[model samples]
Target: MKIAQICPRYFPDIGGVETHVKEISERLVKAGHDVEVITTDPTGKLNRRETINGVKVIRFRSFAPGNAYYFAPQIYFYLKMHSFDVIHAHSYHALPALFAALGKSERRLVFTPHYHRSGHTAFRNLLHKPYRLFGKVIFSRADSVICVSEYEKRLVEADFRVAGKTVKIPNGINLAEFKHLRALQKDEGIEGKTGKEKTLLYVGRLEEYKGVQYIIQSMPELQEFRLKVVGKGPYEAELRSMAKSLGVEGRVEWLKDLSRRELLKCYAGADIFLMLSSHEAYGITVAEALAAGTPCVVAKGSALEEFVDGTRCLGVDEPIKKEEIIKLINKLKDMKQNSRFTTESLTIFDWDYITEEIENIYNN
Candidate 1:
């Protein structure tokens, strides 16, 4: 099968969608399908084409307020020329999906919204009207809507009113890469903490909606652990100030964008993974960390709960408090030595199995 994936962002600009595109495309290529990705030029310089990890990638110029949502004519023009059995558009904000439908491509169109609106504050919630209007246009034209989680499936039905076929396929990870990371693991034990201190890791954009502040607030009480915050975003300065004001600056370690190799090291070195997002259509990082044999604690009432069961991870309430965060961290710290349970639970999300499931979807 020939597949064409359209997304607004790609590699060198790491995020949930970018990682999703890379993981899916790499698996598709490995499964004997020809996969091509079309994304925006984050550098603002137009490049005709490039390839990464056996997948062909094409970039076009686009301008927008955020790095992920871009306004450009090139995307529409590019779709008119390419032909494939499957044209999968990721994210609901980008206009390219609607343009591709306007082109009237005979190929099956699959739209995965990666819907995560709940995390936003009241100010951003007002934009839902436009988002709903956009959804009505594109989802109505789609052959199917591929939702990444059960929560996301409900969001599509309730919010978008998508009449087309809907399927729930959870986000996946490359388990072998994580296994390789385990082989090169390094210890990062802090001096003041005991040998039993667990390293808590948070890897993703440090945006306000991500609930990084809640984790920072937990640090004073979770004195037996160290927190490692990875990735960069516009709210870095404010988050840093919050940590200082909370008097937990010494307990937190901030890291910008990390290479894939460096990321796996963080995963392997850590005892537990923490993702305290206020909203998540699907938290792929939680799945990845679990696959790496690290226990995860994510927020409840969101898509992340669909990926991690109680055996591998714990789900805390949204608007999480410092006491709740500390309690959960202590629970995970106690189970860190349960190697058999962690390894067995995460094996289900290996890339090879995930790729096979997608292959079956395409074949159908």
Candidate 2:
């Protein structure tokens, strides 16, 4: 089967959606299917073609930050000239999904709108009415719509009124690298420390909506623990200030643009993973943390909660309380006395199973 994945962004520019597309595309290719990705250029070149991880990747021009809003017309143009067994259009920005639907290609159309949009984005909010209209058109045109979580499926069903056709396919993780990465990094003593400390890890964009500030607020209350924040975004300075104001500035570590190996170490070495995102279509970091045998605190009512049960994840209903965080730290410190942290096999959500579900979708 030939699959053409249309996404607004791809790696070297990282995010949950990019990671999902990359993982699924690679797994499909490994399964003897052809996969091609259409995405926006990260180099700002807007060039048309390249290959990454054995998949053909095509990039076109886009306006940074807001360019994701206009990917539909570009995808429509690209699809007119090429062909695939399925065109999987991703994102909830309305543009790409609209074009993929409007293009009306003979092949199957599957829309996986990762739906990570906040109720912000002035243009998107202002044009909500027309956005709904366009969304209905695109959604109705698709053979099936895929959601990464039941939360997302419900949102799509509620908003788009496409309840019957939507399906859930949870995102998967690659655990091999994460398992070995900490030992490698510890040997090298990266982050200016020898081995894993009592650490709290945060990975993903440093954006306001991600609610990273909640973790920052919890830091002053956590005296012995170090907070390691990974990924790049616009909210760095504000977060730094919040850390300083809370008097935990010295313990806060800012890591930016880590390679895949380094990323695995950050995940593996951490005593706990934290994501305070108020709104998440799906949180892959929670899965990665689980795969690494690092327990996590995923906030309640978000999609991340679905991937995590109480045994491996602590679900907080609001910005994590200082007392709660400190208590968790103490619990982890106590658990460290044992050789292992927490044991719950997450092999079920591994890429192998996830790809099988996706293959089933394609076959159906």
TM-score of each: 0.88, 0.88
For this target, which candidate reaches the highest lDDT against the unseen true structure? Answer: 2
lDDT tens digits by residue: candidate 2, 135-172? 77878888888898888988888888888889998787
Error of 2 at 180 (Å): 4.3
Report the poorest 10 consecutive residues by lDDT, candidate 2.
188-197
Candidate 1 residue lDDT tens string, 1-364: 8888888878877887788778888988987889998877756665558888899988877775644356666777777787789888888866656665555467777778887654265545676666667667778778878787889888878876674578877777776786666356534432222255567889999787788888887877877778899989887899889889988888789987677777877777777788888778888788778777778888887887765576678888866887887887777666654433455745346656766776666667
Alpha carbon deviation, residue 293, candidate 2 (Å)? 1.3
Q: What is the lDDT of candidate 2?
A: 0.76
Total backbone collisions, model 2: 0
- State the local distance difference test value for candidate 1: 0.75
Task: State each model's CA lDDT, in order.
Answer: 0.75, 0.76
- Which candidate tops TM-score? 1
RMSD of 1: 3.1
**lDDT over C-alpha atoms for residue 251 of model 1:** 78
- Model 2: CA > 4 A from native: 64-72, 116-130, 178-197, 319-324, 331-341
